[model samples]
Target: MRTDSGLRLEADPRPPRALPPVPSAIQGDTPLSRPKKKKPRTKNTLGSASSEGLAQAPVHRPSEGSELPAKEPAEHPEEAPIQRRQRKTRLPLELETSFTQKKASNSSLLRNENGIHVEPPEEAVTQKPRRKTKKTQPAEIQYANELGVEDEDIITDEQSSPEQQSIFTAPTGISQPVGKVFVEKSRRFQAADRSELIKTTENAEVFVDVKLSWTTRDVALTVHRAFRMIGLFSHGFLAGCAVWNIVFIYVLAGDQLSNLSNLLQQYKTLAYPFQSLLYLLLALSTVSTFDRIDFAKTSVAIRNFLALDPTALASFLYFTALTLSLSQQMTSDRIHLYTPSSVNGSLWAAGVEEQVLQPWIVVNLVVALLVGLSWLFLSYWPGMDLSEELMFSSDVEEYPEKDKGLKASS
Candidate 1:
């Protein structure tokens, strides 16, 4: 409408608009329909100022018939600190129904809050019973008749009386079964318990399978055979020495003491060969002992000797010969010496010293060198035999064997 003279003409007053109908489903309160609003942050100072303004500002409620707020709403700024919260739109029946169905679902839950459904455990399954054994009348009279027989006779004719009662049937408080009489006797013979006793099916026959089978004779035979191999080794050396020792002791000494003179008389026969043989046996035994030493007292030397080659046996023997030679020289030299010329022509005439001394020294020196060389060969490798040769050359000069017979009579 146009206004004249700067005065506007007012339009006629308009009737109030009718509100849209609220949905029936949206009418009820629901958790999903609750209001959702953005929180507005305000400075603490401005918030307090607003609060004071609110307290000072007048609040006017709407008239009784009015559907609007009781008081006129406060004017809000474009970006007001106080927010008017908008209520959430209520969901349709289909969405609410889906929600209700999800709540009722047990797929993602343990159970309903109200209760849980449970089925009773299945009853124990029944099984068919086994058939009962048939019962036969016991022959008590037959047992009584057998019991009447002497106890000793029962052993002789064990099965002759049939229908005998089981040992368990005896009324008295007997510890053993009555039927095991022969078994008990057998156990006594076996020197064992009842479990060890055996019974024969026929005629209560009993026999003892004694464990006393390992007799001394059998063990001795086994031991002898085992040691026989060791004996062979020892006996071989003995055989070789026997003749040598005997001849050196008897024939050689006999001839040497017969009579010879001068430097020749200084010589005597020596039993170095026999001494070597004895030492060899000792070495072999030591080797065997090394291998056979009981668990309690084994030594490293014994272990080494056992593993040593058989050829080493000869080396051991040779070393033994050298040791015996050295020992004999030391022992023989300790004996009191005599010059035959110092005695009467008759007493010195026998030429005992001339018969004995020089030859023995020569032989002993030779044996010692041989043994020492052998020991060196075994003890040190490469240039080992050279050491022995040098020693031999040096010691050999001590013996002068130009004479044949030179042993004094003992």
Candidate 2:
């Protein structure tokens, strides 16, 4: 194809071009086309040579559609040479055997038959024995025994024969009652004959022939004296009152006893003293007989004394007077004449007087009755004899004498 320009643009001549044929040698010498050189084989280099051979060998790659079996690497021959070298440099046989034996023994010790580990028991070490010493007795008991300061002679069972041992034997006095019976019968007859004659005696005295120490009898005698004084005072006071009443009858126109109120007013002061004396007498009488009285013989006399004694009669008289005074004070208007100042002071004072007088009467009466009952009970109540309780003797041998005296008295 030409353009429209006049110049004739003839078509340029074309030439066919071709590349020279590649030289066969040069083509064969290319990396992809050349054949590899085979390594030289020798005993010392065989291992390395084989390894190179294996690396140069064709690898079988699996296609996308098929799976191929995995290949394992072959063992290298160099391993044997390395093992031989290590063996040549290892420790001696004896050292190796010792190490192995130690390891085996340790394992055996650590693991039991059941595979459980446990601690070993502690070893016990023996020690030398020690000597013992004797113990001494207390000094106080030893001294007392050596000095013969003990209260009674301690006769051992080996020293005293059966006949000589009085520990379990009954007293001789208690065993023989014929003499005691005769004495009691004779005493009863004498008492009967002398009863009327002795009734008028001021003191009702009983004599005991037992040999008692002064120390044992002191308290009893003191109490007896006190009771005697109290009885004397009581009798004296009664006598004085009687004399006063007579004197008053002659002096005051004898009008004091003409009325109940007058008599109570005059005798109120004496009532308390009489009651006190009665109580004191009862106490003294009870205490005096505590150890001296033989209950079996004196039970009846003691009962009579408590029931019909002069002290009891006086207590009853005073109690009656107090009761009469209280009744008159409550019912009679003449009571104000006795203590007008107190009556006019306050209503409370009047009430207090009554309250005080009532309790006084009740207390005195109750106390008197309790004292009498206590004495009676102590004298006659079975198994309640106070003689044994009140005795102050410490010697066991003296008890036989006391028993004899008690038997004679009974």
Candidate 3:
């Protein structure tokens, strides 16, 4: 078109093209900038490939407008048709978070100096809530600074050798619980006080006092060994008593006594006393023995005390009953005896009543009661059990001081 001035200006009559849609500054990320995900790998066989080929391009094609039969889409097929994926939504940070969106809705919009809308940061708030909290200052450090502690005085880790540096030590006693009291490992075992043991090294968990030596462990082991020896001896003694009780019963109750000579018949004297002596021996024995050993219950040796032997109880009860039986039989079944007078008539004579069950049977029963009950009570004594536990804990496996002392000595 020519202008009125006859300046031929051929301008395109079409209106100027509209500018592209302006991108928002608040837009978080573009689809292209977002990380691409890798597809999982899969193996294929010729059969699958051929099946897919046959399914897609069917041998007999359906007539126009007729739908293809329902078939699964190929995982990856050759000569694939072009397909466009729907554009992914890349919402801005402001829109992605519901919290930020709510806040932005509630808060007035902020504008840059250029009068352009600028989205506030996700965490940005118009006003922050004032929280009342006590602000503590290092008063000690400040005091030290006022005192003008020099760099030399403020010793750092680099300033000292490892031997001089403080170590982490747990509190053993009330007197020193606050600071890290680094105690050197005294290759020598004992300290004057229990607190000293704990302060010396942190590994020793128990604090126990001893009578003579700081070597509580050695004392305990020695004690256990002594008890073990005593138990072994007592066990043998008690077993002997039990067996002899049966023999004693056989001699007294049966006719075996008549077969032996008078001097050998003195065996009756030894056997009868052994019945009562069995209880005496058992009283000393059971407490020394251990029923079971368990380290879980205690780091020490035995957790359970030895129980009373059933054989001892049975043997004693049977013997006591036998003595009572003979006494009763002598009283009820004794023969009334008579002797003819030297010159004239028949005269009355002493019979077997006194010979069989004497007044001493009562004494025997009383002694039996005392010994048996005492044995039972001592076997289950809580105090004795407790003492054993304490001893084992202090001395059984490793008393820290004794263990260290031996090592040092060795």
Candidate 4:
């Protein structure tokens, strides 16, 4: 186009070409610098030249509708399909075979994580070879993993005989099936069974049922044996006390049997001596029986023993006091018999007079006897069982009907 200026000047007539469409990613009109081409590697001239040409092609270029070059995709058609065929075939034959084999193996197992058997498609087995294929290739060896078998535990029944793979021999305590039988007979043997074993072991670790081995009678016998040792010492002390009491009574009687009953009565104050023996027996029996009991229950028993009902103790005390009172009265009566006014004064002059010495000696003898008897009984008495009801259960509290209703309302 000519410019209006007749100086023969051609007008700079070209309008600004519409800018090429810039991708939103590229900012402003400034043209983006292209990446520099890498220098061709000098080492291995042929490989460098080929690589250079490939590298020089535009990178990050948008894909066009152009078709990729056609080429042979894989060397083996029997295995995984060539990359080219994989895109077109929705389901590969090798995968279908693996799925079928897994389903067959899983069906025979007695238990599974999913709990139910899912039958496989018939096409899987029909299309694949039935005979076991020798795992010559790396891909074939990994077929088990692809078939839902864990990598850590991919045992093949074909690899080892049933006897060689047996885990348990005696099967002594196991209530479950024999290991060898399960492996040989069960269709599910090859699949993962660790989940079941894991659950069982976890339960065992937390809770175990301890058989009630010793019956109540057996426990009682054990208690008796243990208390016997304590009884020996207590009984001996009681005997010694009895002997001492007898000797004191004889001497207190002043060689006269006439006032013996009275002398025994006077020694009533000595009754409390038997209490020591009773307490000792009680202590020994409790220690023996309680030691064998569960540690958690021991405290309850001890509290019960310590907090013995006052009424029980009072009843025994009343009887003891009565006996002492009677003995004391008898001694007083005997002393009266030997008083200067009674019959024995005339015969008593020579030996400090039996009357004078008798009462004193009898009292000491009674005291010893009571003390010894008390100790003996104490050491042999069995203690109470306070925690028998408390330890009846060890489970968590169950929600009562009322509580359940309240929860529902909430």
Name the top lDDT candidate. 4
Whole-model lDDT per candidate: 0.31, 0.32, 0.32, 0.34
TM-score of each model, in listed order: 0.20, 0.22, 0.23, 0.23
Model 2 residue 382 CA deviation (Å) reads: 30
Error of 3 at 322 (Å): 17
Worst 10 residues of 3 by lDDT: 126-135
lDDT of 3 by residue, 1-410 (tens): 11111100000110010011212211112212222420110011111322332332321123101321122114222211211010101111111112222233433312221223343343122111100000121223222222221221122322223343235422212121222223346674432443443444332222322334457567766777677567546655555555454454445534633432231234334533454465456554544433223223443332232233333343344345345434433222221222222324433222332344234334334434533443444345322433455446644556787888999999
> Tens digits of per-residue lDDT for model 4 on 1-410?
11111111111110011112212222111112111111121121122223332332222011110221112112222422222222112112222223323344444221222233332443232212211111122232233223332211222322222333236432212122222212223646553354454455555544543325656656765665556556445445545755665675576455555564455345434434443443454344334334323225646434543665332232233235235434555434444444333345442343443454455455545545544444444435434222232333232134466677889999
Q: Ten consecutive residues with minimal summed lDDT in candidate 1?
A: 125-134
Candidate 2 backbone collisions, by pair: none
Please give the lDDT score at residue 248 for candidate 3: 47
Which ranges in model 4 have alpha carbons more than 4 Å from their true place? 1-209, 214-217, 248-271, 274-410
The candidates, ranked best first by TM-score, are 3, 4, 2, 1
Poorly placed runs, candidate 1 (over 4 Å): 1-355, 380-410
lDDT of 1 at 106: 33
Stretches of candidate 2 exceeding 4 Å from the true structure: 1-213, 242-410
Model 4: which ten-residue window has the lowest total lDDT?
A: 6-15
lDDT of 1 by residue, 360-410 (tens): 545554554443343333334321122223333434555545322243322
